[model samples]
Target: MRDSEMTTCAPTLLELQWAVRRDVLGLADGAASEYVVPDGLAPQARLAIYRNTANSTLLTALRLTYPAVQALVGSEFFEGATRRFIGQCPPLSAHLDSYGGSFPDFLAQMPEAASLAYLTDTARLEWVVNQVLHAPDGKPLDLRRLEQLADADIETVRFLPSPAARVLESCFPVDVIWHAVLSRDDSALAGINLDADPVWLYVHRGTSGVAVDRITEEQCRFTAALLAGRPLHDALVDGPDAGTSVWLAHLLASGCFVDVCLSSQASRRATGRQVA
Candidate 1:
């Protein structure tokens, strides 16, 4: 077994560490006094200091990832929810950015946020933006090379989506909510119609930085298939429900695709990248 996977701490020390974790999360305590060394502070007091630091650190991480969600629901409320969320789903990754992906789901299930149906979707959108912002830059596909492909070869071409590309669909107009909350437009937030058709959106890194786009359902379907590494012919097999060429141009122009390869050569190609 890998050293990390093996028990490195002595039994008592490991038990105390686990106890400290439970204490930090406000879970059942493991009699910290027995494990901790005698110091100026009592064991529980020392544990309390750690608890404060842990909660504060995790809270900061959540705020950074879900700023819009925090803005929508006031900071006080957000902090309370985050505390409960931490108790339930503690940090799993050393990187804080990877820690709160499940926070949207946690909020969705919260009784306090039950009235705000759009809250979950808004948080989900924020998570996507956070992810895209942190993802590695991808080499944009050369459209000229695509033009060089013969008609038969074009159909068999498989496009690789940018690493930062993501799609989201929500019954609520989450894009509007995101913009309004981030911009602190109380008027826009107040004017939102909760009962609207689902909006399909894509989050991707643009020429400038992370950006979101409002796309049609047909466009969503087409782009989703391509994002899953489907070939051109298969991605269009069903219905675009709109002009194929137009949607294709829009997605390509939007930096959704990063590289291209022949469907026959996909398995043979070891990596998703294409070298110049």
Candidate 2:
């Protein structure tokens, strides 16, 4: 049958789904025109209702994920920006919570958000906060086991950060801004100097909930290297002025890592052995 003939006949389920999806997204003009409606109901009008509902629900999720951004830009302006964001980045998964992973990058590229350099970084912090909150719980690495390792074994072993741990490095004082917003203290927000130096942050679940801590450059480098799967010896760069013991103690105390494993090469190097 011809394309026009198929439309005249009953629409297939797949065709109907595509039409509804396009209408919800405000795409083609006549994607939904062929649909059958009751006498009182208008297809375009009904689709408009659905379009509004879909956009509203997705926008709500975006707002929740980036509340700080919404607050920085006023509610009305944020809503308008969010509508634009939704049009460009639609939901891919059934779960709304999994959405907006690219929103930070989207804000960075948005023309309106261009003036606010810190906006993208703030969005990133918010996303990491959400990720930490949803991450599964796990026990911290055991200190006793770490202490028992021989010096050679220590260098050959690797450290892994907990599933919930994340690092955010920003040229702006995003941590301070996020804290100020959380505290709801206008004075604190005013006192924060945006011209401050760059910041390295360690975000993870603490005794309470998600905890954000400002870390030193040295700590950032070491933790980042460890997280990248580098063995401890390779990761231990001599920059942090802080002694190795102090850095190690702080890392263990923070509970950033959940497990430790010896690299296979560690054994081979120990006994002058080689694997075939």
lDDT of 2 by residue, 139-229 (tens): 9998887888888797678876787888889999999898888778799889988899999998888888888889887787777877766
Query: Each model's TM-score, in the order given?
Result: 0.83, 0.80
Query: Which residue pairs overlap in candidate 1's backbone?
Result: none
Please list the residue runs of candidate 2 whose C-alpha ends up more than 4 Å from where it truly belongs after superposition. Answer: 1-19, 27-40, 143-153, 238-241, 263-276
- Per-residue CA lDDT of model 1 for 167-267, tens digit only, reads 99999999999998889999998999989889999899987988888988988888888998888888888654559779888888877888888987886
lDDT agreement with native, every candidate: 0.85, 0.82
What's the residue-level lDDT of 46 in candidate 2? 79
Which parts of model 1 have CA positions greater than 4 angstroms off?
Answer: 1-28, 31-35, 144-153, 240-242, 264-276
